[model samples]
Target: MEFAERHDLLNKTFTPRSPVNQRQLFSGRIDQLAKVQRAVESPGTHAVLYGERGVGKTSLANVAEQIAPIWNSETIALKVTCNSNDTYSTIWRRAFSKITFSEKSQSVGFLSETSINTRSFAETLPQELTSDDVENALQRLKKHARLFIIFDEFDRVFQASSTLTLPFSDTIKSLSDNNYDITVLVVGVADFIGDLIAQHESIERAIVQIPMPRMSSVEIGQIIDTGAARLEMAIENPARQQIVKLSQGLPYITHLIALHSFQEAITNNDANVNKGHVSIGIQTALDEWQASIKTDYVKATTSVQKKNIFREVLLACALAEVDEIGYFAAADVRSPLREVTGQSYDIPNFARHLKEFSSENRGKIIERTGQAKRLRYRFNNPLMRTYVIIRGVAEGMIPLEKIR
Candidate 1:
């Protein structure tokens, strides 16, 4: 194959660092897509899509937004990406400005009727806005089309505001209460509504909560099939299974492994990927992702004075059996810690590290789950879990024979 052709195929087929392109080949999440469509069609039924970072929440939202216009011509999909410093007013104003209301010109005569083209209002958003201001803007577009506002990366708002910003919830409540021709679709990293915002009990009734979990092995296989079809290549069953096993239900990890595997195949001028290609792919993925993984580790462990404890704590979690989504409690890590370090340590001893790991913008590598008495923690980035596994073995922190 020519170099440019291979390069183009690689760029289009593998998207680890960015969200899947709207026109690109995508797979799985059929149920989530249907839920979004149903919520969009039902009047006054907004949606809240919450999940881990790389479980394809954004991809589902993006695909839904793209498909909504085709399903309903009147649907106007507006995406507002939140940053750390953005407030409710700032975010809403940016979304409001994208709205353009249109109408068909009405005329009396045949000549006038012939000239009846669609006309739209110019966007004019207020610099300083309030909940009332946003509601009023939605009201003006009532006669035109339905608005589907998608707030992606919404967790950043909470990261910026410890309380999750009450005004934002109030705006949503007010909009729902008034029965505006709008469906606010919130996409974020969270286990429940309370994690995203506070004092918004009123809006809960109007929302359709959809919690996205890890993709099934079958669904993940579809991703491999889709990518293989796109590249006009084949992934051998063993190689495909390796990718799926290592990915742990995260699409980003799948993409990373698939990308390198495909590259390995291309370099060998082979159309089929085997276990050897997959093994090399895994090593390549780890090498490429190590710098960022180390950065997060360094940042997360800086607070611990004893670097050895921090390393052992992280290694323990990585070694623990974390179900499919990489969730492991302190108890789950205890045995692994002792095995790796040849020293005994209790949960309470490293409880501080757990807190730091779950803290936002501090470590922010792991998040707490389950009830109060039985709290379990999962790595916020699935790739980090995979990284820790590889790095531990490479650094001699873990016995190479122990890796599964």
Candidate 2:
């Protein structure tokens, strides 16, 4: 029975995790997947992945591990994230744990090389291991088998780069040049790693590199169908187009918006997802984007990015309503953004963001009709713009619509 018919059935929304249900919502990433598969199968395949945040970099890696078994090789994938506390010792210990985790290790033959003499490591481990201790343990572990250690978000260790407790570059190099049975994969997007590489060329050579690509509209539709399928909710045709356009063909955004829309509809006791719920979800997604910008975007901490992103998107969403406005361009609404932020950004930057969701990029502005190109720069997430407009009005940054 349809959700509308079964009033007794409970409603639930999906949650975001490391690897989103790609099979369900995973869209056009076959080429990307094949590239990653090749990396995992190759020995000592060290790679650096770069993409807009939420572009499924982590999911790709997770998927890489899942498909590793298909290839004829003993693949043990250990995924550990790097952060502020990732000292040399912290890295090795976490690397050790990830490497040893039964979920990954059991599939492949990963055993400590040295005598199971955990006496010292055990004695000192409960307390955080300093950089020195980890380096020592790593040297000891070197004797055993070839290990593939993946450090996700490796750029989070920006501050510690100058004072690295262990010679990270040298270690990876020694293992690689020596062709030790060890490999390293460092993944991040914070840009610090790329900058760090310029400063230290040798470390750059030790690792292989791979950058994840964005999703296309067809792929995004697949994600929407997958997400809706899970809820037993089939999206109306128009809603799918709105999602694809609003999400800018991003898998993560697709999943996020779809999940939020489903949640909104279920929460409000709606029978099926319609434009109303999608509107609400767009707002929620905007709020999340605001929170994300505020989290580490210290430069424009006062919701600077939020303000602009929201302003342009909000205007477009409002503009999208008029029937003649079948296709609205962002350039059609730049004035609103300037008014909202009280300052101008690089028009090129703003224009680029029309396609790229990141604060640094501009949203793609498209003309709905006519040979004359419609001009506009809207945000990738309509919700992001909505959140900004609401907050701006709340902060007295932008006046109410009636006043505007």
Candidate 3:
């Protein structure tokens, strides 16, 4: 059997309810999915769906149509991924491409088609469209069903270009405020967009954020059972136990683990996927994690030495396996870092690196308290720290005092 035929994991080839521009696998997050459905169906409002990577944020955007059939059976949703490369022209073209209209968009009616050009649109979009022959094209759109858009990977687009702020704030922000019945949903990592929205008047007025919560274990079990039944194979007890222990109810990791175990099982010619396969998958996962951290660390960062400097302070975070909420502190980290680096760092440089490392890790490092004095450092992902510690990429989060 081919890999697709034999590998029965949900991530491998799970079926979505509808035909979409991108492939989507809906495994869990019934609750979060339901919330997005409510927001989309509510009408007269816009929302931002933000979350960590590989946590089904984009998939949710793609499969969000699943809820449409329930509400009106005619609700139309168009999803777009925005990155640094996306511009006024690109976004307009994309909007024209994804959204349908009562009449063909290409047939000119009023505004000059030249004004629809990227550079022109960059300066004056709908305003230019109003003056150009393309106004007829846009009016044709109003004749169609109400348009809804979801922008996925929004961070990549914002981070990719520096000059894009004006175009972005104008195109997307304006789309949200135009007083049209169209609803816009933007989905991606939450890091900078929150502040970006706060800065823009139109953005602040038009947008409402609806964050996706982390996965829960009960829902995870349902996904596990669903994936297994679809595969026509049973998960061995040992594998099940190991997955539950390691996954911590995280959906992406859960699917990745399940897929890896299934592949290992098929390779071994075993009908049942067991802990041995899970153990191998776990090790492979850690190795991949180490490599990924190294790559991103190097890209977003300059040197491992620089990364290591901060590591000493975050040593307490590197070992924390499960920080559900809250964080550890830079104060607790300073002395240990000095101990590791074999040198003393003054408070100023020390504070800079501490904040820098926290910025580097961001949500991965949980905040223990809202106040600086009360704040503590916590790993955003418990398992990622565990992976780093096992690979010797980071020092233990457990203070040395506890080793005694």
Whole-model Cα lDDT of every candidate shown, in order: 0.78, 0.55, 0.55
Q: For candidate 1, which ten residues in a row score worst on lDDT?
A: 114-123
C-alpha RMSD values across all candidates: 5.3, 10.9, 8.6
Please give each candidate's TM-score.
0.80, 0.61, 0.66
How well is each residue in 337-370 modelled by candidate 3, as lDDT tens digits? 5645667766566665545655635322433435
Off by over 4 Å in 2: 1-13, 16-26, 69-73, 99-146, 199-206, 267-272, 287-404
RMSD of 3: 8.6
Q: Please give, for residues 36-93, the per-residue lDDT of candidate 1 as tens digits.
A: 8888888777889988778888788778778889878998887888888888777887
Choose the strongest candidate by TM-score. 1
Worst 10 residues of 2 by lDDT: 99-108
